[model samples]
Target: MTEPGDPRFGATHRRFVIPTVISRATIGGSTCQIVVGVLSSGSATQRSQRGELRAELLRIALRGQGLADPCTVGVEHDANGAPALSSPHIGSVSFSYDGIWAVVAISPSEGRIGVDIQMPRRVSPTVLRRFAPDLATRADDKSTYSEFARRWAAREAASKAAGTGLRGELLRTVLPVARAGRDFGATYTVLDGWTFPALSLAHKD
Candidate 1:
């Protein structure tokens, strides 16, 4: 695995997975890559419950590029509401979906990686009211739910990244919006931005 301070993710470091195909990109440039062949492609429930194992496997493969072990993810809901990985080398990796996508990300440095898989769908005020009662107060812009999602995703990712459950860190918990100048929600505000590669696989059944 690549060391935390390797600078592989820096701007000077190439992003082969995004600009070039993973096959063509150098191994180091693709520490993160999407896994294909999903067992279920259209349902978050299937992806979350079933594809999780496959997703981690792909994550391992991505880590292998950096010479790190992708390792296995253990499912244990903590009081904080984030999923936890049993391995230390795995860094902070989290799994999630938007009823349409299965996604994951790893933080090679902060051990605070977070990613969210979201499907493009219409949002209702009621759903927002249930998850985020403070929506009307945050921003009146068009992407209010998206903002909520970002916050929710970040909460989930951060908690999971720290191996803490999401039970304690819900929206109402009132934790800081960011850490070290990095907005832990929606994206990695710490390093200016964060990109997580997702892998999807299908079940033979």
Candidate 2:
């Protein structure tokens, strides 16, 4: 678990093999930074409060980046259901929560961005077959539940960035690359003492 200000925080693992913490990415020459935070007590018990912590963290991130006060920032869903920031300089804000942890990604430039964080758990074969058949095919002999969760996290994160949110065929979507034994290009990692698959994307037009 690394603190927000630690040197290693907000670094990108871009090797396409392993997960990263507080990771970052570049799109169209602009950089997007992701900040990870623990879920709030209210968020843990109340389903409605799930996004509160992430949103607040986003506000903090924005402010630190020299944006307006978090209270003044607006988070609204697009026609496609992707989250966007109201501020002009800060292009987009995306968040993901998995009951235990929350992550917020902010694009410093004009690119769109999204993020997702998921706690690794046992995934049943049936669920895998429905959501990710490819993973199902190889998971048994070559992959573990953790790997499945990591790949799922990548898909979810990419979906969020695309502003589609699993509306399309999971297999047809852009599958995030994860090397068999190394980390690269949007892999997952741990942050703030939480072991989870965290992903971020910064896309340019």
Candidate 1 weakest lDDT stretch, 10 residues = 18-27
Stretches of candidate 1 above 4 Å error? 1-53, 56-64, 68-92, 109-112, 119-142, 169-171, 174-205
* lDDT tens readout by residue for model 1, 1-205: 2122222222211212112112111111224332212223333355344454344434543554464544444544456565445654544444555443444444333334444433323446665566666664544555664555454554554444444445543544533234222222322322212222321111000
The weakest ten consecutive residues by lDDT in model 2 span: 11-20
- lDDT, candidate 2, at 136: 69
lDDT of 2 by residue, 70-137 (tens): 67888877787777777666677777777656677777766555566666677677777765666666
Report lDDT (Cα) of residue 61, candidate 1. Answer: 35
Query: How many residue-pair clashes does candidate 2 contain?
Result: 17
